[model samples]
Structures are given as structure tokens and as C-alpha cells.
Target: MKKILPLLLIVLFSCSVHSQLNRTFMGKDIQYIEKNLKMKANKVQNLDNGLSRVIFIKEKDLGSSTIAKGEGTLDPMTTPPVSKKEYYTFILDNEGKVIRTDYQKEYEKK
Candidate 1:
């Protein structure tokens, strides 16, 4: 039982992490990107080398953005005067298979 418990825990954790990606456009084809990551995509670009990027306003929004756009929002008055958007990048192969996912570095808020 002890050995089985540890193995089961590892399987569940891995599934959780992978589910997070599966819930989004990650590991999916580029054709579905717009439908998947639109509203929060202040910007999106597809590169020649099978790389696509979607940009969002805040770190917290970045999470929601991946799941679906408009899931997160910012208040104009509370928002900082100078702020930058977070970038979510997807790497795909020639056949349009998602290779990996990465995010831009988050800078400290002043």
C-alpha cells in the first residue's frame, strides 16, 4: 500500500500539470490559437520557425489568458501608470504539433 500510494500520488500530480496545458491551446495546433487565446491576446504573432506568441497585460491575467481570454481584467484607476504585458509563447513543429510552451520573464512592479 505504501509503495502504491507514492506511485499514485506521482501520477496524479503529473496529470494535474499536464491537464493545465491540455485545458489551453498548448499542445494543440496553431489553427485553434485564435479561438483559444484571443481576448487576453493584446498581441499574437506566428513565426516562420513554428513559434507563436500571445501577450497579456498582467501576471495573474496570464493564467486566465491561457485558459481563455477575458477571464482576467485590470482596473484603470488601480493599474500602474507604466506596466508591461506578459508573453506566452508556443513552439510548434512544421506539422503544427506544439513542441513546448514558455513564458516571458516577469519584471518587478514598482
Candidate 2:
């Protein structure tokens, strides 16, 4: 039972951590998302015809992946490449309800 207890706790913790962003946000109101997910959008763009887009940016370091081409030795002086940023965008209708969602990840320049 001891082994199972630790495994179960780990599973539950991971589930809550990973639930921050998901497809279930579709059709949910903006307030519900902010309160539940504890996330504030980085930017919001208002579109024509009473539509708006909410964007949340999350940046994470992916660590070094550079391969030495000269002597197969990593250079200590060189800096690692910038990691990709996650963009979570939600399109809301005039009534402030989520209508669609989009997610993308790409490396951004400093």
C-alpha cells in the first residue's frame, strides 16, 4: 500500500498542474477561465464585428541542445539558445464567451 500511495499522489499532482490549459476552456466565460486557471492574459486584441482575442504567453527554458561541430565539446563561453514561448489564444464573441481557441509554440527573438 505504501508504494501505491506515493504513485497515486504523484498522478493527482501532475493532473492538476497540467490542467492549466486544455480544450475544455472552449465555450467557457473569461471570468471562469481566469479564476479557475489562475492566469491573466498578456494581451487582448479587439477585432471588428464585436470579436476579441485573448492571448496568454508562457515562456519556458528548454535547456541547451547545441552540438559542438569542431571537437564534440560544448563551449562554456557561448550562451544557450532561447527557448520557445507558448501562446494560448482564445477568441471570444461579443458577449465575452469563448468561441474558439488556438495554441502555438515558437522561439521568439529577444
Candidate 3:
């Protein structure tokens, strides 16, 4: 029981840390984004317009399994999962300061 208690405490503490780190807001500084998300970005580029754009692409949300069919809800026991493509772009000025941020969703290709 003592060992189990320590393990649970460790998990809770780690969860707290992870949640804090995952907190994000718009208009954050370019440096902050670069420092935190460079490794995760699909592409980081300095444009000819003397600005930088860092793009992060993810399909992090999966649709629910329950679906409405013929006025009744049906839950598939084993079926394909659905996901949406998401794009996060951070636009930075010449001084490496963020000018704006854009989040876009595109239809997934079949």
C-alpha cells in the first residue's frame, strides 16, 4: 500500500506538470513558440517577405464512435476512427516578434 501511494502521488504530480505545460494562448511571443514548439513544428521557414512562419500540423481530435442512423444512435463495436486535420501557424516579424497567429481546419482527404 505504501508503494502504491507513492506511485499514485507521482502520477498526480506529473499530470499537474503536463497540464500546465500544455496550456496555450493566442498572441504569445515568437520566442516562446520557438522555444517550446520548434521540435514539434512540421515546418519552420523564413519567408522572403522578411518574416518567419512556423507551422504545426496535427490530427489530435478523434470523432466519437456513436453515430445517428435511422433516428437511432448506433455505437460501432469495431470501426474506423475519424480525425480532423488542424493547422497552427505563427507569423513573426523581422525582429522575431509575433505579428499574428492563425489556426485553420482543412477537410481530410479520403
How much does each candidate deviate from the true structure in C-alpha RMSD?
A: 11.7, 8.5, 11.1
lDDT of 2 by residue, 1-110 (tens): 99899999988876553354455786788888777657888999999899999988888776656454677565534446677887778899999988877766688543
Which clashing pairs does model 1 show?
Answer: none
- Which segments of candidate 1 are over 4 A away from where they belong? 1-19, 39-80, 105-110
Candidate 3's clash total is 0
- Decide which is better by TM-score, 1 or 3: 3
lDDT scores of the candidates, listed in order: 0.57, 0.76, 0.66
lDDT of 3 by residue, 1-110 (tens): 98899999988885663344335534466557757765477878988789888887877556446543555445445334556776777777777766666666665433
Which candidate number has the best lDDT?
2
Worst 10 residues of 2 by lDDT: 14-23
Please estimate how well model 3 matches the true structure, expressed as its whole-model Cα lDDT: 0.66
Model 1, 15-83: lDDT tens per residue? 664566556755677657646655444656787765655444335422112223354555322333333
**Order by lDDT, highest first:** 2, 3, 1
lDDT of 1 at 19: 60
Task: Give each model a TM-score.
Answer: 0.40, 0.60, 0.51
TM-score-based ranking, best first?
Answer: 2, 3, 1
